[model samples]
Target: MSSDTKGALLDVVKGGVVSVTLFAAFLNLPVIGLPAAALTPFPALYFGLKRGNRAGIGLVLLAAVLVALAGGPEASVLYLGQSALLALALGWGVARGYSASRSIATAVLVTLGLAAAAAAVYSVASGVDLHERVVAGIRESISQALSLYEKRGIKGDELKPFRDALEQGGEVLSRLYPALLLIGQSIVAGINVMLLRRFANRLPAPIRIAPFNSFRNPDYLVWVAIAVGFSLLIDNNVVNAAALNVATVAGFLYFLQGLAIVRHYFETYSVPALLRYLFYAMLVMQAYLAIAVALLGLFDLWADFRRPRKPKNL
Candidate 1:
């Protein structure tokens, strides 16, 4: 058999192990055994990487059925449908060889895709009541926190912060039910990649790019600059702090991506090549910095000097 086939099979076994382990931890493996309830599209994630669309779609259907059974037909259907779509989209990207590794652009795309799809589906589906489902999850988490706080046999102002923090988190989650899926998918994908590599030797490497390549995208630089400049210009101390945090993270992630690329080269090739690659990548990333800033500076000219408007509704 081809190594790829072996890798694919390993993917299935690895995914099953991961899912079953989760089920066992939560539902008691020795007693109820692994819930066939979760055996659907989420697992298709593994299948998709190894196989193709047909296998992926089939897995989705299976997982959807299981999810429906566990979550109640309606909730399960809604969630599985989302999961199926997410898997398909992710699978397609994988098939097309999009980077599955973490990077800001990838992070943004994944977040937007999941959020946009869920928002659209929820908007269309009657009685799905996303807000309510969200509230329920938050309530459960808050309940857990409250349980912990109460167990201390202590009552004081300290408990207030814990409740307040949880409530704030719940508020954020209420609007971002999709975030739960995205976060879980990212986590699962990372774990799956690691396991496949460690055990099955089926791991695929992310396509190497110059770390600074992200900086070359003019749009990216513009938005990042806006983000940073706005942070520096903001009046409120809290907002300023938040802006600084954003700036710091973006700078760090972009730089870190370059470092990662350089390190990869060093490990796979020679030290000289690694240094050269790092230098080039750094140059590539910074290539647009000057131009982006120049364009931003020319904003007034762009606004005040609009092109002649052609007659409309002629």
Candidate 2:
């Protein structure tokens, strides 16, 4: 066989094996499993970007088949939604030379659409309300945690307040899960794109991605934020829920823009890498700090924090 054909076949095998390994780690390894899950798309993304579309699709299918054999059809579906689709969509975007933001957005939207469609199909087939199922799952998880806490000797009155708080939190989670899922998928797409940028030069053709420090969302998204804010004032539950979800997603985007501005200043001032890492850790650990960063990004529209003000003509 031709060397090129042999190389392609080898890549398919390698990529498929790596993808399955990552998925398995995600399932069996508790501490690092989440990170492993996040990286599950990388192999397909890398191979697809390096070899082409068919190689990427082949790798994903192989991984899915392996997962199905070991787990079930449900697990394969999960793999497709969580990793394969994102890998395929991102590969399509990058091959067409889309910008990093555009590529990530496309991948996220495509995955979300497909996932929603799948959910709808399942709901129809089983005559089950997915929303109630999600809410029940959240409550069940909380109940298990509370049970563990009770076993640790927290009883009656003490546990009552804790249970109340957890139940309330579960309700909020159920209402906002759509937004949370969108933000999560977006993060996954962004992470893969950032990783891809590191290896872009190794690909068969040159691809350009602008530096993250210079990233900015479109100016018009601010208007959407304003509309959503107004929507929250409405008394209707549906409107309020929809508004909150939009706000959550928009807030995440602004948070990213905020991080870009922070990075810009960090580079300009040559901040020490250690300090940068600490600050990022703080952002993750402290909820208020993340909100503050998102606010900083929102205000950047007027402040132009990264750019110097043009001198006024006398």
Per-residue alpha-carbon lDDT of candidate 1 for residues 134-212, written as tens digits (9 for 90 to 100):
6897899898878888898645787888888888988766654444444445444444333433432342434322222
In angstroms, the error of model 1 at 108 is: 7.6
Query: Candidate 2 lDDT, tens digit per residue, 128-208?
Result: 999999999998999998999999999899999999999999988999999999999988888888898999888998776
Model 1 Cα RMSD, Å? Answer: 13.3
Residue-pair clashes per prediction, in order, are 3, 0
Model 2: lDDT equals 0.92
lDDT of 2 at 206: 76
| Candidate 2 global TM-score | 0.96
Q: What count of clashes does model 1 give?
A: 3
Tell me the spans in candidate 2 whose CA falls farther than 4 Å from its real position.
Answer: 308-314
Give me the displacement of residue 102 in model 2, in angstroms: 0.7
Shift of residue 264 alpha carbon in model 1, Å: 6.4
